[model samples]
Target: MSWTENIPTWQLVLLSIVGYVYLCRVLRYRRLQQKHALYPYKNREDFAKMTNQHAYEIQKYLFGVEFPFTMQKALEFALFRTYGIPSISSLLVKTKQLSEKQFASKRYADTVVLISEFMAWSPEAERTNAAIARMNYLHSLYQKKNLISNDDMLYTLSLFATEPCRWVNRYEWRQMTEMETCAMGTFWKSIGDAMNISYTPLTSSSLGWRDGLEFYEELHRWSLQYEEKAMLPSLDNKKTADETTALLLYDVPTSFVPTGRAIVSALMDDRLRKAMMYHPPPSYIQTGVETALTLRKLALRYLALPRPHFLRHDIISEKADENGRYHRIEYESEPWYMESNTRNRWGPQAWFKWMGGKPIPGTEGGLYRPQGYLIHEVGPKSQEKMGLREFEEGREVLMKAGRGSCPFSIGK
Candidate 1:
């Protein structure tokens, strides 16, 4: 106070304002710390018991509240990781899902919708059950033909479990705590179990993992080895990657497309770039992108306010419409399951689509299905009426198994 008294009034006022802002910033981080403190990091017994409900809460906090945009990007990149594997890309090509840009876009949207349906809802919710059943029905078609391998399935699941944690730690404001990472493992293990994917490849499969963290660690190790062996450059991988990358950059302005592709390349590791047969991004561009991401992380950590619960980002709509249909809250290239209403067709964003000569909802006369989507019917149009019986059978199995209990306890 004595020193401030010697200073000019303007300087004193400036200092006071700066002090207030500093206090607010400190308190903001404290709130985040306090919220994280809710979980039991020290109690081993209780920690091991943390399963579905615990995972759902923590994931809600992470994905919907804290790092929604970043988490979405990470998961999107996770999907891209699968295309690096020749077998997976070959299968996708054979199915004609990645044959054309439009088909690729539709396939991408369908996957996003299906995954959001389950991940955004309670593990035991009827909607979640329906989503999982629909997925099982679709996979059964390929499984019946022996086109999909179990190790491939396991590897796909591993990326979902590990990639987000890796991405957040690498690029986001903060790294996930062990408890948070454990929750991710617990949640996805439940999903893999639901899909009937074998865990035999994991070293701990014989002994059984004691908790989600253990499962996560074992899966991570196995996935790395699998990638080293399976991810190799191939024509199939390049074609799929090219089309998918095009679909990803469809929204960007034409002039910036090269830069956009470079940014995507910068995100890929050397192995993924090689597998996709992509050249390295310019060294300058790579450095610039990494620098930009680093700045964003620092800004978000110290300056951005904590996202409020009310402002959480949901990937899927919370309630069904009068017709018992749900709408996806977001889409990539095409609006596969979005309701094409006046707002959607004539909104500000719609103007951009119109100017770009891109397809908008309601223009193709139900080709994009202006009508909303039913949960059980989201898939390739040819299979709209096909998987119903298998879907019903799968749904029955989930219900009998207690909707969403710990997946590990299902057959015990």
Candidate 2:
């Protein structure tokens, strides 16, 4: 008898599934290997240093070598702001629509992204690890020379130094007064009493207790815990006054940056959050205004993915098809959504797309996936893999690897 005819039907089905998965793994490995080959070194730290050097060259090139300041500034501002979005070609088109005057030039416009596909690395992340590695080197050097104390060096190096940034035009930087940077916040709060607005510096991050929310608790803790000072080094030394000042003030640790203004716009304004929670998609990410939204500038979802395995106590039934086979169907679907959980709803392709290649919408601990007849923990790379800087990164780490490491590690 033929081997196929002799084998059990279930075994044949299993064999087919196994074969398909093995093919997928082989393809994925090849792509990953190619990416690895493109880089100069196997070490992540060294790669980051290379990235920083490239950024320096890119900076130098922009400084009047190839373009005037006006063109450069507009390009940088628009590009920097919209760098990480997937479908970057589409995103670019959309952004240009929003601010055509600034990003009209095709060269600078298209130059902004590293990956434009839904689940690919942005130009920024490609450069970030290198920048961070460079920061570590600089800190090591400073510690060796005793230029900065250990705590100062670590906080500065870990938090502020590696932050991705762009040079704003001098005119634009000057245009944003303290009032505007800090406006829209407290300004909106005291709109009914215009006279009292002056008492609160619209830009002051130290407030919010008066608003009865105390949402700035973390920011307050940060300010109290650390005070920054400038320590200029000699010419032979690499540290400089301008960098010191920038890190001390404007480039506060990524933790301190108020990253999710859109979330605030959604949550604090109960009306907006209500709309998002109860709504559908297509207008914005979750059916609101499509201004801008991202989960820490990483891959974004359309609706909240509702990860923590939304609990549902629902009715289940079987529907008879035209062929008379009963198909399992769920009715009166209660999505069982949760906002704060790690999962947020993007489209189907988002998970694998945003994170190199892993299961998207999985649990906080991770999803157990089947691969080539073996169980694999399919999810995002852990923070340990990347050494991420803040809360958002931590959340991602937990989602990807919290239960433990590889499934093949133990006595299986």
Candidate 3:
């Protein structure tokens, strides 16, 4: 009491505020860590048996609740990283999706929508099965033509499995625990199996790995070596990279576009920059970007409140409409595949979009298809009317094989 009396009134108030933040917000992840420790994911056999459900829960917490925006950014960067490889870049350029500015936003939205179809739903959900079937059908066309290689496919999968953890550990308020990382590996490996991607290149593929963490580590090493050999500078890489970067920055204010590009470049590693044929941003710009990221991390750690469950990010609408159509809850530059209802067409957010001269869902004609999307219709426009039989067959096959079951227990 004597010490408190000695302190200034303002100082005491400040202390109380800081204490409140520390107690309420700063320890959210700590609480989650304790809760996760009670789960049975620690044992190898138990983890394998519950991989799909456990991984789904953890991912829902990580991507949908705790760090939704951060994980989304990480995933965008993960996809961006794939463009560094010349072979992948060449294929993308040839596809004409990224090459045409008119279709850039649609291409991006299609990707997000398709991935979220499976990701935002339960492992055993019919929508999840249908989405995977559509994806497999599309990839199978290219595979049959030999336009895609197993190594390239594996590298892409590795990035999807590992990059989120890497990004969080480096930039978030807290690093992912081993259990969280292992869950990521387990989930994506199951996806790879469904896509029929091979793992023969992994040293442990023959003898089998002890757990998800072991599998993740091995894949990480292989990805690095593959990048070192394959990610070379080329015109195709630069073209695809530049177009993608432009698409990403399309929403920035015109005056700040250069600064936005610099900020993005600052986040990239030297190898990626070189592969994209991009020069380094000025040292001052780099320093500014780094400082901003550091401050963001600190603010989250010390000041920001924990994201409440009711406000968890919705990657897609939780339920489909009566017509079996779903709309995206979030989008970047364009509202492709979103429903053109009155709320979407003229809501408060729509006014801001109008002021910016950006395309609003209903305002645009059938160009962006404001009618919403079906799970199986998400892909290149050319394939929308095609592949119905193959899609159904793939769906049936995945269902029969118990795609939602424990991945390790599938064949056994």
Candidate 4:
């Protein structure tokens, strides 16, 4: 009453409205949580069937819609693994000259491409095949570069399978169902098989499939032992590891790097935190973050509101482009192919000559027909540019068949 008497009428009204709205939200959140607790799935098959039916929506929500948060969680999960950290740090050290420049956006772009391609939705057969092909390509490229060991590759694959589910289940508005977990496990197993990775873990459940939770805990325990023996051996390597962590957070302002490190420490398990010699964030900061996240969860779950779809459909799109329309180049296309070529420069001339001088495949009827000099000189800019027609036609076919166009389809 005394505080109200001191305040202006408008100010008092605004404060009352805010307080009422917050109270309503808290009540609704409690009701929703109580409702959700009533009927859990009866069995694994029931969960799997439900998840399979909504696979597209689920994938789109996790990877396409909530990508920024999902990506942060994924990164945190990777850093938590002791062996995983060294493997990633070593790869970054070998690939980019980060010290020369603070950070390069292209490195991040390349990673986004890989993640989008793997998670993009299509027909089951098509999606699986595309993912397998991409995985194979990446594995071959890494092997050729001698960037990672066999053990490192297997460990990385396991993390990929387990971490997203763990992160989402822990922090998202709703917990992931057993079926959803199984679906991810199935998808990742297919990828691991395609990569020919050995040492796959077996789930204890008679569900005849790998369980994400079991695999994650098993790997976590094994990683701790592995790091103690192998990762912590050399003082010089430890210094390099610290440098690599800084390089990873290069996008963060210098003044905020310590805060970033502390947040990462807070997210990790006690064993990993101790192993990395990381101090937790100040209690106040940690509590603030937790409270904010809890409020977000309550709002998301109780309001029955749609999840935010902030991520661009085309991962390469600029932030200013709200519609998400952007030029997308396929991995096997001209400029992109050249970028991946480690040896000599692969220009338009070489590509055209390899294509038997024709603009499109199956066009020449196997004859030694050569296009004119003008066409050759015009190169990729020519209307009959290499890969142009095939890509367009394939996209049209996908569209006509009720499937969406490829995310990486080249623009006109």
List per-prediction Cα lDDT, in the order shown. Answer: 0.83, 0.26, 0.81, 0.45
TM-score of 1: 0.93
lDDT of 3 by residue, 100-213 (tens): 687667778888887887787766777887888998888888889888899999999999888888888888888898778878877787778878898998887877765667
Q: Encode model 4's per-residue lDDT on 71-187: one tens digit a residue.
A: 445743563353325554555555542212323223333343444544555434343233344435444546777776666766676666667767777677766655445545544
In candidate 2, what are the lDDT values of residues 29-99, reduced to their tens digit? 45435534653534522322233223222322222222223323343333322221122223233434222
Candidates ranked by lDDT, best first?
Answer: 1, 3, 4, 2
Any idea what lDDT model 2 has? 0.26
Going through the candidates in the order shown, the clash numbers are: 0, 11, 0, 0
Q: Over 4 Å off in model 3, which ranges?
A: 1-7, 25-27, 43-50, 409-412
Question: What's the lDDT for candidate 4?
Answer: 0.45
Top candidate, metric lDDT: 1
lDDT of 1 by residue, 1-412 (tens): 5877789999988887678668757876786678768766545455567767668778778889888888989899999999999999998888879756758887888888888888887887878888999998888889899899999999999998899899899998878877888889889988888899999888778778777787888899999999999999988998898888898898899899999999999999999999999989999999999999999887887667677889888767788889888876656577666678888788877788889887777777777766778878888878877888888888778766653555444442
**Positional deviation of residue 118's Cα in model 2 after best superposition, in angstroms:** 20
For candidate 3, the per-residue lDDT at 186 reads 73
Per-model TM values vs. the true structure: 0.93, 0.21, 0.94, 0.54
> In terms of TM-score, how similar is model 3 to the real structure?
0.94
Q: Lowest-scoring 10 consecutive residues by lDDT in candidate 1?
A: 403-412
Give the Cα error of residue 62 in candidate 2, in Å: 24
